[model samples]
Target: MMFVIFISFTLSSITIINGVHFRGGMITWEPVSSVTNASPNITLLIHQRYAWSRSHIPCTQTNIFNRDLIGDYSFNPIVCLSSSTQCNSADYNSQRISSDVYCTDINLILGISSSSRSQSLSLRNNTKLVLAFKGNDSWLSLTYGSPAGEGWSLPVFIDLTLRPGIGINHSPTSTMPLRINIPIGILTSIEIPMSDNNVNDVIKCRWAKSAGTINGLSVDECAGACHSYTLPSTVQLRTFTKNRCQLNVTLPYVGYYIVALQIEDFSSNSSTIALSSVPLQFVLYGFDSYNTRTTCMTPPRITNMSPFPTSNGGNISVTVNGQYYGVIVAQTGCVNDTETYIANFITKSPSAMKTSSFPYAQNNTSQYSMELQWTPTIDQLGSTLTFCAIAIDVNDYSSDPFCVNFIVGPEITTTTDTTSTVTVTTTVTTSTLMIMTTSTTSTVVATTTATTSISTTETTTITTSQVVTAITSALSSDDGRILALGLGLGLPLILLISLLA
Candidate 1:
């Protein structure tokens, strides 16, 4: 498989705003250049898996001041598909931005409607870039940010990033890269993290409880369907894929969940190599299986999210701020068992973030929590504008869900769209991972201390025959006997502490 690149000049960063026009990332970023010497790369850096590749088609560039979007500096425009139902045959040409919002991928106009699609564009400027996106068309618009969510407008943690499972240029063609637009409350922590595990890798997940009633729903404009996965319950969608290729299904609904991952042989039995094979790629810092001894895909880390109380008051525009983190390989889950970990957080959102996801090392322990501050509109604070915070990990519900309990406020009046800033004084934390992990949602934020405390683990001692044999064999030697005598139940405990920490 092969693909080509149409370089529009590298950018400092990538952001998707207004409606997938490509502003930067879910969170805002100024154009950055610390990494690439070139201008901005229009590839999405949300996840390295979705990062820029040499083969992807390059979208054009526009000055932050250019709003007309006139002229033919791009490839032939195409229709932006409205919905799967609207995947019409007509090749309607459309424009990306005009005067409302700052844009990126908009350089290449698409076919149909303007949507909140999740598309990535690699831009130049490595770091100092301030990326922002919103529907500024109407006064008091709707907005989301890097630490993306309904009211999450936070600065993304710079160091939380890690290498991706697949290279951005790995996609052979445009059709090959699975680009998707996340829905409201559906935070994308990882992208296309499909593992090439062999047969019988034994994928298993822990459950807080079983879902009594499972209802399926559909997103009117999306290609996938949503599931009303009633929770406090958990299960592995792919404990063991019946087929060898890959299990690529979309659950278009909201709730908690995580990748119950593994690899297997032809018999669908546990394989020795597991995820070590070449074709297999794991999320870097996510809640993935990076442990030495893998058990049923590492004990099913994280779970579905708890329902969030929401308000659509006046659709008033607001800005949110927060931070992010990631957990990598060579690291441990937030807790020893994924089930118990997720069970604590599941009460917040059926789809909450967890500590045990892929790409686990880097972000999981970084400075991801920041004070969440906001001022609601006079009309909203007392009415529609309600704010809350939840500290969620890569796996939405792998740990206890934190909240600042939301309260509606009256809509506040602003003098100009540029100055009046509403603040939500709260805290937020996010983590990333490695390998192919399927996690839940980003609910609230907790104190970094609370989160870090959870990272501490317990020590267990286990004695083996090797120890006794060494003891007996060494007894004959004075030094060996001394060493053997010193070795007791405490030895394993000490070793356990070192390993867990």
Candidate 2:
């Protein structure tokens, strides 16, 4: 369906600033061609999606100055809807910027106003060539840079008056799109976005059965209340508000349904002044399936595992950042089994591996983070371990697995001492080495040496190869292996590391 707006040229010259008026978009063109053959399409790069106005509110001046706005002009003489409640309307509001902030939110204007070219365009160099049209007034402000009679002439500026046309923020002759899935037997409130036409005009909207294929279902037959229904009469009183004109409905069935809606503006006398018909449309959805494989249940994801290269042999705290990690869902009396969750850890051959979860650590619908504690045994030295976590919901559905890697080892440093006498000093930084294995075979490498000096005047290097061989042989004995295993068994330790860095 096509709707035409008639522009009238007989409106007053005063600016209307306190209320919503007409809503529309914009267009662009070249006013004057440059001598260098630069295409006059300065704003051709701007997409039409960026150049939209609802209730006379425009986008930010930065969007305009950057040539991101269409029509190349600002819509002034407009009031901003800054209230938290008024600015959240899905139709007139983008929900991207704060309405309370000036130039950060769009303005909604209607009716008509007459202003000079300078007033309409803000008279700035960036806005110099813009041509703005709204209500009954239109103006063109331009600057000519080409050589005239002799040298560069003064910049040319022109302003003109034009007829005012009525504009709708939303398409008046088309059906709005609605698509959503809702779980059955659950009380839910859905917000339907609609446009607020004018303050003097009250909008009345209603939904009726539409005959056609909608959401892959026909409205010719009723699928119980779940398959089809209409908004309660009181919904009009509960849904419409200043800057937010919408419809509210409670759907209590599980099936596809076709719904048609119509909105009309009424004057204070209760007479219809304008009409908008939403084309027939369908909203498709089904009852929520509590299976783990259902697409609605997003799997858990790991955002970050901090403190990479974790040091061994110390108290270490591990922080895991993840989404849909695990949430505690309060159970209802229903037997659907959709509210239970269990979080577990998996690792390969961990030594002295102990686990503890933070009670009520974190919970959200699908976003969560958990803190875990563990200490590696001496036997796990120099070994890198990856810990994988998975969450299971009440319906036996398991989320995707997330893992983090950590290396177990202590910080090592070396030092040497030199004296007047010729001496060679060797040091084994740590005296104890613990090797852990399920097998019976064990290998040992040890260096035992004392600080000794040669009496000869000339520099002499003494070799302790015999002493090292003796130590290695001694450590290989059964008694030596028993001692090493005893030292390896110790309390769980934690490595303090920051994963965010």
User: Highest lDDT, which number?
Assistant: 2
CA lDDT, every model vs. true structure: 0.22, 0.27
lDDT (Cα, tens digit) per residue for candidate 1, span 478-498: 333223323433355457669
**lDDT computed for candidate 1:** 0.22
Regions more than 4 Å wrong, model 1: 1-76, 79-411, 414-501
TM-score of each: 0.20, 0.23
- List, in order, the clash count of every candidate structure: 179, 25
- Candidate 2 lands at a TM-score of 0.23
* Top TM-score model: 2
